[model samples]
Target: MSILVYAEHDNKNLKTETNKTVTAALKIGGDVHVLVAGTNCQSVAEQAAKITGVNKVLVADNAAYEHQLAENVSALVLEIAADYDTIMATALTTGKNFMPRVAALLDVAQISDIIDVESADTFVRPIYAGNAIATVKSLDTKKVLTVRATAFDAAGSDNSAEIVTLSNVTDAGISSHVKDELTVSARPDLGAASIVISGGRGMQNGDNFKLLDGIADKLGAAIGASRAAVDAGFVPNDMQVGQTGKIVAPDLYIAVGISGAIQHLAGMKDSKVIVAINKDPEAPIFQVADYGLEADLFDALPELEAKL
Candidate 1:
């Protein structure tokens, strides 16, 4: 059976999430082709063609797919859906938004945030806000999936796959691109960062968040905040990490003064190493932590900064 992967990329380059999704596709073991749908995205397609296990690359250079409009992108996938047994994409905002529509149009169930491919049809995914792991089996002829990139290793770039231009295309003209107002930061993107240092209500105020700046700079870590910190207006909503916010699976996660609420754990419980620093010895975060430091963050932050 053949698999078609939706290549997630900016017009200039392929996103790292796509590399990880390609790793997931490789695990299923098949003729894997990547589809790059965008406007003047040949550079992105060329990069996708270099992924180790890709059998081929399909490029649909179109103005209609510039913004990845769900209607247009879903329609584009549906046009080529018949050529492959499974269609997959990274479980990021773009994938989550459009894959469901593709599934509905194909009359198939879409398995989301799949962490493991148990078999060709059975998959493992987090459910109930990541409190439970569910094994799902799809009996549909065509399987649609959004892969959790953090659960898989990125595919290497050691192949020279053939590139094919797709002439058969579809556009619904249902939406148009508006100006994008994105928050640009010098630090690593939260989802892609290897190490994340997050603050919580313990910060008490916005100015206190500056405490994490030194630690973050020392380790080249991204700064994240608990929902409490964001709710209290200590940080921008974009910096929040929780079930309600962005899911993160970093190599190391340091929680400062953050009470480990279930809501908070849902987003970061999957981190490889967890360190919780709170004066409360019994905070729920400590239960899941690899290292727990029970002390006032005010005292600990300075010492930790000095030691690091």
Candidate 2:
């Protein structure tokens, strides 16, 4: 039995999450094969081959897969599903979008957002916004899963494997192309950041976000916002840190002006070291924080910046 992993890339550059997915796949007890589907992604395929446990890399270079459209990717992955006992991908936007389609096409349920490998067939995953862990056993002939990269350590490039080009181009001719709306930021992306500094409604206004600049710069942290701040238009939705937005596990998370709602805590409680600075001594964030500072953030920001 072999396991197939889908390698995610932007056609030109490989995403770091692929390594984490490969690492998780290695624990599933099988020979691992990584599939790189794109128009011209040989370099990306070769990069996947460099991951330690991958046995072979399949490069499906096709015009239809140029954009990694869910329909095309699902068709291509489903075409090869019969050859493998398990199919896995990173539980990112790309995988979440396509993996369910593959499962539906195969008439097998997908084990979404797997956090632990119980066996070759069974897995552990989170349900109800990570409040509890569910141990799931897949009964299908082929087990399909999407792994949460943040839950596992990433695979290293300790060895090289064979790179095989897959020339089979199965085209699903369904195109609903639309204009892309892109938001670029100099600050690190929240999902990939090692440290995050988030603010709540206590920051008061959009102008108060500047208070975090010095501290974030010193710590190399991404700026994040609580739901209240986002709802107030103090920051964009992309910066939101809560149960509904991105789940982040960083080395250090500094919460300023945040009272810490249960929804917000659910998203960041897993962070290694939580530090909270709030004016209210009775704020809920203080309950979980490793270090709690009950003071005005306006006064604390400069002091924290000076110390950092």
The TM-scores, one per candidate, come to: 0.95, 0.93
Please give, for residues 1-308, the per-residue lDDT of candidate 2 as tens digits.
79999998878877778888888888887899999999778889878888888899888998888878899899899888899989998987789999999999999999998889989889998887777889999998888899887788778887678888777787677765475565677877787789999999999999999999888888889999899999999988878887777678889999999999988887788899999999999999999999999999999999999998
The C-alpha RMSD in Å for every predicted model, in order, reads: 1.5, 1.8
Residue lDDT tens for model 1, 195-280:
99999999889998888898898889999999999999898988889878888889999999999998899889999999999998
Which regions of candidate 2 fall more than 4 Å away from where they truly are?
none
* Local distance difference test values of all predictions, in order: 0.92, 0.88
The true-versus-predicted C-alpha distance at residue 268 of model 2, in Å, is: 1.8
Q: What's the lDDT for candidate 2?
A: 0.88
Deviation in angstroms for 44 in model 1?
1.3
Local error of candidate 1 at 264, Å?
Answer: 1.6
